[model samples]
Target chain A: DAGVTQSPTHLIKTRGQQVTLRCSPKSGHDTVSWYQQALGQGPQFIFQYYEEEERQRGNFPDRFSGHQFPNYSSELNVNALLLGDSALYLCASRLVGASTYNEQFFGPGTRLTVL
Target chain B: SQQGEEDPQALSIQEGENATMNCSYKTSINNLQWYRQNSGRGLVHLILIRSNEREKHSGRLRVTLDTSKKSSSLLITASRAADTASYFCATGGTGKLIFGQGTTLQVKP
Candidate 1:
């Protein structure tokens, strides 16, 4: 009955460095999606993973990548990060093909600070 | 690019008052969902209205969707200080969600 969970509540990195944030989806969920929310803005879709494959992606660049593990957990990796990359990284998960209207459960975001 | 935009970027009202937030989207969606975030944290799902549905209610929250206008509005009735949060509307289509810049609502006690 646990909800979505994320690790590294806070991270500090410099420009050009790489950082990885992890997320464990809620029980009985198989799809994971990542989002980035900058200050004073809504979350921008990053990518979505299902069945261990990326099913959809947003307008993000190649530097932003993600992986879905067999257990339905997910990891968002940002490479060569810039100061602008500093934001709250959010993870949401849902059971694909569920009868419901694709309602996603979100986890407490990981605060990333890129200096 | 964000698909939805919320109106009155910020709103302040006293407790026992009602708070309304509107969202307009640019594209068609299968469902529209409203989420509440407190202080940049995780978003809590408020309600989801399907494309076919016009209005839905959950507790003190009432959501109205006007598909023809591509807009949705969330009404929080008799608001309490605990209702203070940033409200975001997300459009769901193609399995991915496109979010709007949230409306910050402050319900004063």
Candidate 2:
């Protein structure tokens, strides 16, 4: 089976512009989460989606939003991007019913460059 | 932030040697997980230890958790150059996973 997959391996955007990254979760997975990994740092959770609804969110601002489709795929949208928004956008997936101890599998990630 | 913080921000060792990384978090968690990321890539889950567990082993990896101290350690034995990467510790609670700053490990051949 294929693992989690992300689209537009790399993207370039400028300040004040908007961008949307897509993610296809692993087979048989229903939950999807997005993370931002800046240079030289670990990933920062953006938000998690389940059953087409947001289940949890991190400290990110309102500019960062996401959506989960009925098929369990997800999209992360960042509005009014800043230079600091340049980072690797990672997508992770897990089965909400698998177990209490969730083990997330990640995708290759989309590299976002804000100028 | 409930993110965990890893010690020795960076480490370099020769191949065949063992590598150890430590992580400490600030709050209680349902589980702690370790992940490895190659340069410019996404993270790959390494292991997960629940709050009640103290130690777990998988192949060359040995993970020990001390919930009382809010700390965990990951040990990789017989390391290889391919093992070079950034390792991160993440604490999971209430459906959210907070990550640590990460430790960069370089295993030279």
Candidate 3:
């Protein structure tokens, strides 16, 4: 089975510009979450999508938004990107169930560089 | 703010030696997970310890959770150069997982 997959291994954008990253979750998984990993830091949760709706969100601002398609794929859009927004955008997928310990599978991530 | 913090930001050891990393979190969690990330790669889940559990082992990896102390440690025995990577600790609660800054481990051959 295929694991989580992300598109455009890398991207370059300038400040005030917008960019969109895509992700396809692992087979049999329905939940998708986005994260941002800055240099020398751990990933910070962006938001989570379940059943085509946002189920949970982190402390990110309104400029960061996401959508989940019916097929469980997801897109993370960052508007008015700043130089600080340059980081590795990661996508993780999990199957939510009664158990709260479901493992998350992450994609290779899209490296975003804001100039 | 991030919920978890890992100590010894970076560690370097010989290939045959053992490596240990510690993590401390600020809030209660249903479970804590460890993940490994190679350079320019995504995270790979390593192990998970529940709130009620104290210790768990998988292969060369041993994880211990001290809920009273709100801390967890990961031990990798007889490490190899391939083990070089950044290790992160994540706390899972309220349907969200918060990750630590991560510990960079370099196993020299």
Best by lDDT: 1
Candidate 1 chain A, which ten residues in sequence have the lowest lDDT sum? A95-104
- What DockQ does each listed candidate score? 0.79, 0.68, 0.71
**Candidate 1 per-residue C-alpha lDDT over A1-115 given as tens digits, one digit per residue, 9 for 90 to 100:** 9999999999999999999999999999999999999999999989999999999999999999999999999999999999999999999999877866778899999999998
Query: Which candidate has the top score in DockQ?
Result: 1
Interface RMSD of each: 1.1, 1.6, 1.4
Looking at model 2 chain B, report the run of 10 residues with the lowest lDDT sum. Answer: B90-99
TM-score computed on alpha carbons, candidate 3: 0.97
Please write out the lDDT profile of model 2 over residues A1-115, one tens digit for every residue.
Answer: 9999999999999999999999999999999999998888888889999999999998899999999999999999999999999999999999987887878899999999998
Q: What is the DockQ of candidate 1?
A: 0.79
TM-score of chain A of each: 0.98, 0.98, 0.97
TM value for model 1: 0.97
User: Model 3, DockQ value?
Assistant: 0.71
List the lowest-lDDT window of 10 residues for candidate 3 chain B.
B90-99
Which sections of candidate 3 miss by over 4 Å? A98-100
lDDT of each: 0.94, 0.92, 0.93
**Residue A60 of candidate 3: its Cα lDDT?**
95
Selected candidate, larger DockQ, 1 vs 2: 1
Residue B82 C-alpha lDDT in model 1 = 99
Off by over 4 Å in 2: none
